[model samples]
Every structure is written in structure tokens, then in C-alpha cells.
Target: MAGFDLVVRGGTVITASDRGRYDIGVQDGRIAALGLDLEPGTREIDAESLWVLPGGIDSHVHLDQPQPPGIVQADDFLTGTRAAAAGGNTTVMPFVAQIKGESLRQAVTAYHAKAAGKCYVDVSFHLIISDPTATVLGQELPALVHDGYTSFKVFMTYDDLVLNDRELLEVMEVARREQALMMVHAEGYDSIKFLTERLERSGKTAPYFHAESRPDIVEREATHRAISHGELLDTPLMIVHVSSRAAMEQIRWAQARGLKVYAETCPQYIALTAKDLEGLNMEGARYVCSPPPRDEDSQKAIWEGIEQGVFSTFSSDHAPYFYEGSEGKQNPKARTSFRWVPNGIPGVQTRLPILFSEGVSKGRISPETFVALTSTNHARMYGLYPRKGTIAIGADADLALWDPLREETITQSKMLHGSDYTPYEGMRVKGWPVTTIVRGQVVFADGELKGEPGFGQHLARELSPYAKPGRPS
Candidate 1:
């Protein structure tokens, strides 16, 4: 047989369902062989004593997204994908949000332009349907889905983004017919508005009040309602960034009844709390994401959800905004009212490490389960399985070689992202990814970036099998 293009030797391979020591041979960016004593390749690495796993797929990142005047996200495609590669991810799916009056295609086109020649890891897009007009639901959406954009997210909160019940159902109906997955950001808009007005009427306008205004009940009620919509339409739904126990119970309730309800939780839900949003001098603004990190009890519930299989994927939900800049978390209006703070934190680079250290290293979860949450499940959920999310032959050589015993303290200076700060600073983590390979090439190795911008390719995805309208067990 002709010699392999590259080979990774003597590493313990862990996939979502399998684990063993093997030498992986790569040719033309695909796994060509997996066994002991593989033939020599043009290039080889001694991966002894390391845990070799599929590179992470952060399915919920925001890079160079359009924002209102005077507000901007920190990372564009180049820096964001570089950070993703450095952090052991081979694929990232950021959103392509439809502007209020613009066609979805226009948004997709503009987004593609922004990403062209500016990525270091593979990229895909998830559409955000903020304006599901009659024409959109009738023609544009179905066409987009058929063109390989098979999953789209809708919101139930945020003044400019929220879709009313009727509009949401229209979109869900299209999803049902098109066999596309529907992702929802479930939070009651009116309830938050009422609470915010009430709080501001009094003296409770601190950054901490951002948590109080949109309490768990807001998410719970909206989650239940969104699930009900899916149940009515017999469509599968994915609830994104679930934080509160109340919302989780709603998802659990739907799943018990054999509804096709999938859930996703983020790093914030497991690592931070609402109290983190109570910093002095508006410093709390850094942690001011929507469904803002709940209390310790809620944190426990999030972990429980992960252990019990209530969550199908763990994503970064990386919304990058600098804390000290006028366009970021500390924007002029945000200085006075928590309501004005951008609702997200930077985590695309830190997502895998945090989960590995807290869940796998601490024994809260097996490494196999960790792979399932951070890698395999994301691929399956987003229709990239077999191709992007496994260690088997014929899969892409998207790999992260880990030093399972390595320990490092988290700091913004060490991050490759464009953000000015990281919410995970000072966190000590075990088991870092020392090498990240994409498409048979080492993109990041030994703490140095090896991939150049534009090396990554855009992927056109198929419909997720999980999007089908039946319970999965």
C-alpha cells in the first residue's frame, strides 16, 4: 500500500461511544486507517500517553455579527476561528441573523462575505429568523433549508428579535414541513419588559438587577410555551442556553411524553452564578448574559441535566463584548442600567477545557461522555456526524491531542480571541489540548498557531436526524 500522508501514533483514542489505544493514519484529510502498528507516513507524531479525541464543535458562537449602532462584538471570523482552533475545535457554527426587513438570503450573503478568507477552522452558519414574513415562511426559508442551511433559531425575547406566538408557529410549521431543526431562545419578552420598567421605576437598576428582572420564571414560562408550540406542530425543538432548573423541568416534561425536544447548555450555566454579576463599579457587566447565570442551586441543576442526558450538546454561545469599551459590556447606557449590557460572555476558546477539567477530570463525567457532549453530539445535532465528529476511519482528521495531566491557569492574555478579557480568568484547568489538527493538518500545536487564515472551508450541512419528529432514546 502507498504510504499514508500523516500518522498519529500511540495515543489513547476516545470517541463518543468507544475508547482504545490506536495509531491513526490520515490521507487527504480523512482517517484512512486506525489500528496498532500502522504503516509509516510522510510525517508522524509520537502521541504517547495523550488522550486523542475529536476536535470540539461549538455550535453556538457569534462572530462578527451585526449589532445596533455603537455596539460591536469583539471577534470577527479570523480571530474567532483562530481561537477556536487553538482551543481544540475544528468546526464552529455562528449565526446569520436576518435583519428585521431584509431577506434571509441577503443576511446569508453578507455573512459569507464577512467570513471569506478569514477563518482558521471550519465554519458553518445557523440562521436566526427574526423576521419570518409571509414570503419568508412560504418561499425563502424552504429554499434556504434545501440549500443546506437546515437549522435556524428564533427568539421569544429581546424587543427587536422576539417573534410572537403566531409568527413563531408559522416558522415552526415551515420547520415541520421542511424537516429542519428549530432552535429557540426562550424567554418571555413582555414579562422582562414589565419587570424592567417596574424595577427602574423604583431604585433597582443595578447590574445585578439584570438577573432579577428576567428571572427563571421568564425562561420557564417561555420554554413551556415553545415546547407546546412544537408539540402542537409535532416538530422537534432545541432550547438553547438553558440556565434555570424551572426551564429544565419543562424540557424534561416534554421529553418524558416522548416529544422530540432537544436541549443545549453552556459553560456559563455550569461555571458561573448570578452573584458574578454583582461586581463592584459595574464590573458585573462582564457576566451579564441573558438568563444570566443563575444561583448555585440552578448550577447544580444544570450539571444534573448534563449527567441525566437532558442536554444533547454543550456549546460556548460565545458572544464577545469587551468589558471596558464603549461598544461592549461597558457601553455608555450599560454604565447605568443592566438592561443595556450586551447579553453574552466570551468562551469559544475555553469551553472544552472548562468542561474537561470540571466534568471529566473531576470524575463527574466519563471522558466518553465529555466527548459526547462537546463533540459527537454537536455533530449529530447539526448534521455533521461521521464526517466531523468521530475518530473512526473515513472521518475527517479533526483531532485534539490532550495532555491529560497538564494544568494551566486561565487568563485573557493567553487567549487567541479578539476579546479584551475572559470571564474564566484565573480558573485553573487540567487536561489541556496541546495539539489541534484539522483536515489532516496541525492547525495548532504546542501552544502555537500553525494554521493560516482561509485554510478553513465552509460546510453545507444536511438535515439533522434528530430533527425528525419522534422521541430519541
Candidate 2:
């Protein structure tokens, strides 16, 4: 018998652009071959009829950061990656943020310490420039990019994190020079703040008001401004959590102009809506998030954007905040006033199955498109391509075996995220990961995590293609 580390037999292998039934052989933490069965191996897993694809890459997540008073994320690197693996994702890229008055280098160092050896799978970081000083804009940023910290998010919304036009230009110039990607949280801070104060005075103190305060106009306007800024800087940009039709139009308009503007839509944008927050009592607080989910009409626009290829990738935006639990804001029940309620939901453990059921089962997207949005595109845009998001010979042996026939009603308690409530609670989903492999090792299987907590590695990523600013050769 030929010696191999492991053999995944009887799987219908698939990638972002192709599919076939094959037996994949893995050895020394890499794919040795993926074709017909030719030899035996140490471990053989029967994946007959299952969807064996590249492990998902969740490009947007906030693993651990002190979001400060009223909102602390529940999952650290340990629990976050566990839930990610449970959801069939073998790689995740989270932000390492620099708060105002903090050093960029120091902040990155601190984040690495918090995440080291605690992750459940391979992970990387995208830095956030909350304070773009000269040192950060010059030496530190360039050095970090070369060291594999190639992408960063710059906010245009929150007072503590938002950057003005001048500041944004400076940040963009640095990103352009370093060939790094910039992801923006595009919401007009001044406009949204004006609406928030106005709504409070108008006696609209309900969870639903959170959506109204920063209506689609706010998101669209900021999307336009961010795209324009990138154009002026000749850099590429990605607008995260685009939740409305108007915002999609802005990105579409920019792309039509031949701008490298990318968009990402989350599961919340497709699965939930403003009506979810209309529920009575404190129950509605669960649906609250920054740039809140729009109504059913906007949901349709998001779905259309997916089919039409407006969104280059998909992510969980997995910002966990416990609802009525020890890890949550003290007053999780308070529905009104954005300050009192935390802005996030636990979905890292449920993103894939929801998309598979709603998109694939409904024929809105092909299984190949699913892999593209969930894996390949993410790796390509984020500079992790061919290594973490494909089924090639040299890439990491990260795989997700999906059982399409499986059925289950998702509940917060059933997931491993630290949150006590899921906005998706009671929703039924089909198709989920029966097994997840990282470095040829099965970490999630038979409804349980089969490995220890410290098996994950912190990946260093080169500058992303989108982050590399350019107009042409």
C-alpha cells in the first residue's frame, strides 16, 4: 500500500470554478494529489456525495477588541475560531485596531499576543487606522504591509473611529504607496448623528428607530464619498456591510466608471430585515447593529446584487456581543438609544448553511458561485489566494465537507459563540458542515470539535490586490 497522511474518499470535489468526484490525498499538511483512488492512506474518510470544497475564508471578523463601554465582543480568538471551524471555515481574517492615542506598532503587537496559539484554525489580521499619524502613515504602515499586514479598515462613521476627508486622503495615500487594501465602514457620521438626535427628540425610541436614524441615504452617501476618495487617491476600496439598494447603486456607478470598488454583503443583509426589530419588548434588541439591516425591499436588492456580481466576496462580519449574558453590555435589554445597545450578532457558526440553503437550494446561485463568494474571492481580494482558498497541490489542506441533506433549526444556544441570543434563532437551514479540516486535520466532526483549543496558527498575509492602489500601468 502507498503511504499518505490521509485520504478523503468518494467526495465530489469542487472549487470556485470547477467540480469533480475525486479522492484527495494529503500529506505533510498539503494536498499531495486529488484524483481517482490509486492507493491507501493512514486515515480514509468517506465523503460520498458530499460537497468537498476549499475551506471557507471569513474575511471580515472582529476577534477581540475593547469596543469599550456598552459593547464588548463575546468571542476572543479561541471561541471565535471554534465557531468558525464549526461553520466549515478553516481561515479567518480579523482586525487589529489602533485606538486613538495609541501607537500603531504597539496595537499590532498587543493584538498578536491576544490571538497567539488561541485560534482554532489559520488566522490573519487586517489593521485599522484609527489614528493616522505621520509615523503610521509612513514607516509603520509600509513596514507592516511588507510583513504581511496588507489590509486595513478605516471608518467613516463612528466619532471615535471615523476619518475626515483630509485624514482619509492621507490614509489612502499610505495604502496606495504600500499597495495595501483599505476596507471602509461607509456611513455618514454627521448625517447619521443628526438623524439619531432628531429621532430621539421625536420620541422614536425603539429598536426600529436605529434603522431609521441612519437610513439608506446615510449609507449611500458615504459609499459614494468613499469611492470618490479612492478614485482621487487612485486606490481600490471595499465597502463592508452594504445593506441597501441605494448603496449598491453607488458601488455599481463607481465600477461602471472603471474604478476598483468592491462590495461585501453579509448574511444578515439577506436573511434578516427591519421588521425583525419591530418585535415587542426587549426581544428586538437582538437585531440591532451598526448600519442596521434594511427592510424586505432592501433584502431583495442585496440578493440581486449577489446574482449580478456586485459583491466581490461574502463575510460574516462576525462581531459577537452577548445578549443578556455576562459578556454583553450591562443593559442588553435596552432597545432605544444606540449608545445603550450593542451593535452585532453571532453568525460565524451559521453563515454557510444559511447561504447554501437560501442561495443554492433556491437556485439563486450555483454551487460554484457559492465557493467563489465564500472562499476564492475572499482569498484573492485579501492576498491569501492559492494558499488558503483553493484545492490545489501546494495550498493548505483546509477542507469543508458539506452534507446538503442535513436540516436543522438554528439557535444561539446550539452554536459555540459566546452570545446568549442569536438574531437567527428559530430559523431553519439546510446543508451544513459535517466535517472541517485544517492542515489535513479534522477539527470539527460528528457534531463536535475533535481537536484542542491551541491548534490554530496566526497567518501573515501579503498586501491584497484590492489594497494595492492603481490607475493602470
Candidate 3:
């Protein structure tokens, strides 16, 4: 018999804090050894001239979400996880949204049904607490946290989902007491609503107005408010999808004061701008998303945040919606008003490639920082650390082999997502992941999928060390 189940040889293994040319030995889906030379195995892969990095962990994605009547999400667990795998992601975390009048447990059960036996990569869940009732906060939420649903998100905007200040405080108290991480979508709802109504009445209803209605000040103010709430409650909070320099400054201020205010920024903030929402007719609807992309100055600020460590994890926030379908971006009412347009773009399959080409290939960041932002930090923040986000012995053997010189012009036809279009279509990127392995199994290689839907498993997470209240400064 061979000495090991598998061996990957001759690749420059890159981790968040280390890099070296090494061979890896795998046994029973876990890394058994890493050294200059490993014992011969039953299977061997020659990884010469490639960069072997930890598989990405996209901790924020939307798959098979509950939508309004005329709106529909494009990808379910099968297609979403497949796209994630193609992009070199071995794990993804999508939301289980609790609707008003429903129990949080019920929402989780329903989401599990949707994801059962249909994923191509491992999955975890975050709870969207839309209805924080007495039972939820006093009982259900704590129980769920103990049961491994250790993080939950709350909205400060969206009319149907927003929580009042008292409600927000109640939720944060639970998070602090239970040591569960709290994530906030920080956009001022009343301010946006005020501007949106005025714009609609003035007939400024184009998709471009979507950006105008929710300007940087709204995000800035809401971010500051959220940070203050976390401070008051002595809780750690993560502000999601920050898109403006002003908002980033707020987070920096909190951090300087020794507050645990983590921040996240998506690819849209770096690659696109308000101008993308000005496409002629209804075409611009494709770029519509909450806290819409801002000006070039804002883009520069986002890049600075990444470099300066103001941002914690870089996520895709992939919310897939088709452009032409009636139930997607082009819903009948959406054509008439920006408010009705589905608020997202597809990017699960392109998130890492964009960062690799733009950030690492251009020397804006080193390969080590790339691994930290795309993989390691997410694992640390979401409680999956050494097990899923590194190449250490006894960890899951999840890896992505990259061709640092490969160039490709992105196109929807070349993508594996279920969406009809990609917002980054025609954009050129210099580096790409040529092979992806999950749990010691080669799942994607040479532009083909080698894994099946049921190969992915659901993960139960531990309470994140980074999220514990009163953590060291």
C-alpha cells in the first residue's frame, strides 16, 4: 500500500504568515504532513510552478434567498456552491433570513431544506434577524448560538427589515451576553427613504438615482451610530458592505478608540462606480445594490482601507439576479422605478480573481496579505480558523493552485454561475486559480468540475474568538 492517500508536490505553499516550496501529504481528507519531500502516495499531483494557497472563504453570499413577490434569486445551493468552487472557494456562508412572525429556528430549518444534498462546496449560515421578539432574544437566539449558529446580522435600513433603536439595543445585548458576533448593514433608512421619495416625486427615477438617494453621508452617519451602539453595549460588531470614505473613517475612529468595530468591503466598491448605474434606459439596473457604489475617490478610499487594515475580510456579497428575466432585475415595476430593481449583482465566481489581478499582481498587496484577506481572516472572524483556512498539519486539505501569469478576459459565457450576465464582463485579469481542492479531493481543475453536488457538507461553527466581548485591544 502507498504511504499516504495523496501527495501534492513541488508547489510554493503560501499562508497568511509564511511561504515556502513544500510538498503536502494528505490522509483521510486532512493534511498529514508538509515538508521538502513526502512519502509516495496512492495519488500524486505535480504542482510545479504554481502557487498553492488556502481555498477562499466567502463568508457573505446569498443563495436561494426569500424575495419579494415579483423578484427571484438566480442561484440556489447547487449553482451557487458550484460557482464558489470554480472561483477557488472551498467554503461559503449564506444567510438564513427570519421573516416577521416566524421563529428563527423555523427559518434555519427551511434554509437547510433548500441546501440539503445540493452544494458543491462546504457551507455555513448567518442569521438575518428581521424579527427580534421577546422569545427570540431571551431564548431562541441564545440557544441557536450554542447550537453553532454563532453569528447573526441585523439591518438598520430596509423598511421591512430595519430594527428600531430599542430593538437594535435588545439584539446587541443578546450578542454581547451570548458572545455571538453581530453584523450590521449600516445605512440610514429614514434618510434614504426621505431622499428616495423626493427623487421619485421629481421624476429622477433612473437607476443612477439609486446612488443619489443613498449618498455617503447616510452610510457615514449609520456606521457611526452602529459603532456607538456596539460600544455602549460592550459588544463587537462588523459593519457590512461599506462603500464610502466617510464610513470607513468612522470605522477607523472606532478602532483607534479601541472599540471592536470590524469592517467589510466588496469587489463592487473597488471595480465599479456610480457611473455604471447610468447605463442607458434600464440597462444600468444591473449595477444596482444596497449602499450603491460611489465615485472614484471612494474607490481609492476602499483600496486604502484594505492596505491599512481597516477592513477585516474581503467578501463577494454575491447576490445573484438575472438582468433580462421578469422576476429579476427587469421586473415590470423595476423598469419604472429604481426602488423596485433587485438590489444586487453576481460575483461569487469572480471575487478572488479580481482581487488577485488588481491587488496582488499589481503589487498593491503581497501574496501573504491576499491569503489573509481572502481566506484566513474570514475563518478567524467566523470561527473556522485552523481547520478550514490554513495548510497546517491536521487541517482540512483545502487548497487552490494558481497560475500567477495566466490572463483572462471575463465573460458571462466563460462563467459557471447561473446568472445571465456578470457586472465584470470584459474586464481583464492577470492571475487565475487553475485547480481547486476541497477536503483533499480535486473538485475543479483545468476549467472542468470534477465533483458532484452532494460532495459539500454543512458546517457547524464555534463562537469566534475575535467576537468575544472585551477582547484585548
What TM-score would each prediction reach against the true structure?
0.98, 0.97, 0.99
Q: For residues 1-473, could you state the per-residue lDDT of candidate 2 as single tens digits?
A: 65778999989888988999999999998999878974888998999979898999999988888776656788999899999999999998889889998888899999989988788888989999999988888788888888988889999988789899999999988888888888999999999888888988988877778788879999999999998888988989889988999999999888887888999999999999888888776567788887788888899999989999999888989888876753463364454465466678778888888899999888899999999999999999988887889999988899999998888899876798877777888999888889999999999998898967778887788667666555743
Where model 1 places Cα greater than 4 Å from the true spot, the runs are 470-473
Best by lDDT: 3
Q: Model 2: residues >4 Å from true position, as ranges?
A: 325-336
Clashes per candidate, residues 3 or more apart or on different chains: 0, 2, 0
Question: How far is 221's C-alpha from truth in model 3 (Å)?
Answer: 0.5
* Model 2, global lDDT: 0.86
lDDT against the true structure, per candidate, is 0.93, 0.86, 0.93
Off by over 4 Å in 3: 471-473
As for lDDT, the candidate ahead, 1 or 2, is: 1
lDDT for 466 in candidate 2 is 65
Among all windows of ten consecutive residues in candidate 2, which has the lowest summed lDDT?
326-335
